[model samples]
Target: MSPKPSRGTTRTTQYQGNPRRILVGITGGSGVIYGVRLLEVLQQKEKDGIETHLIISPAAAITIKAETDYSSRYVEKLATKVYRFGNIAAPLASGSFRFDSMIIVPTSMHTLGAIASGVSDNLIVRAAEVALKEKHRLILVPRETPLTLIHLQNMVRAAEAGAIILPAMPAFYEKPKSIDDIVDHLVGKILDLLEIENALFKRWEGLSYS
Candidate 1:
């Protein structure tokens, strides 16, 4: 059987490279802001020699316009390289192209289902499959609530295939002060999963019952 998800800190281990390569896939989902904020954080990491590769699905482009003020063009500029979702020929589609990790922020149920079923009709799914087959990190942040049995089964299938199924659920214990604070909390967790360091949100120390 595929190994159970590692409860250890293996995900935090940084690979040695001048510029650690990270691939991001954005699908059409309600929380487009999660992907956008993640891009913003990684762009800053660019100054520290981190290379960010991006692929935004066609539906994501529409979601970006519908949900946020920022244009997809602006988001594209945040990445070191941006690939078309339909470009199955992109380097990321090959397992030979090395990247530290791949994350699909605000991943749609459709994309999750596709990945679960080993469907690689698009570059995003192909790259995610590459990550899984190559034994590299693949994180999927699904945003849907009131999940149906089908959705849960798909999630389980993806997890069994060695993908990190991170739902876009925020913790209120951090005492978020604004919308950005909540977004940062989720982005920070994604960074944490990929072993990237960040101070995007307040960490909980402990609770005092006194």
Candidate 2:
């Protein structure tokens, strides 16, 4: 089988040392803006050796255009490269490709379920599975709501396989006043997981002076 359909421009104008080989997968999750914002932050962090390899499932393309001022064509330019999900033969589809990590910015339930069981039908799932088997960082930014038992079970399975199930749950501790704030907070958390340092939001460690 192949990954879901997608449409948008594919090319990037951002480049630097680009030492970071990061594969970013966008599923059909609701929080599409989070994925886009995450890319923007990472793009600006080019000095930190960040490079993005992107692949957005069909649904993600539609949702991102619907929910934000951005278009998939424009967003695609933020990354170093982009690939169709159908191309499982891509470099990222193997453990030897040597990526620093793979982040599913807005992982959908279906995609999450697929990864949980070690299914490698497409590049996103394969990249993640390879990351798991190779012991590289795999961060899942799940964006589902009112989770069902099935969702919980799948998350558990992925976690057991060394995938960090970091849902798109925003923190209120930053007292965010806008949607961008919320998205930025979640992106911040993701960067932290990728071991990239940033001051995307204020820390809420409670009365801390250090």
lDDT (C-alpha) at residue 132 in model 2: 82
Q: Global lDDT of each model?
A: 0.89, 0.82
Query: Cα deviation in Å at residue 206, candidate 2?
Result: 1.4
lDDT tens digits by residue: candidate 2, 59-105: 88988877878889988998888999889889888767866778898
Best TM-score among the predictions, by candidate number? 1
Q: Report residue 169 deviation for candidate 2 (angstroms).
A: 1.1
User: Compared to the true structure, candidate 1 yields what TM-score?
Assistant: 0.93
Off by over 4 Å in 1: 1-16
Model 2: runs farther than 4 Å from truth?
1-18, 205-210
lDDT at 122, model 2: 84
lDDT tens string, model 1, 35-103? 999999999988777888999999999999999999999999989999999999999899889778899
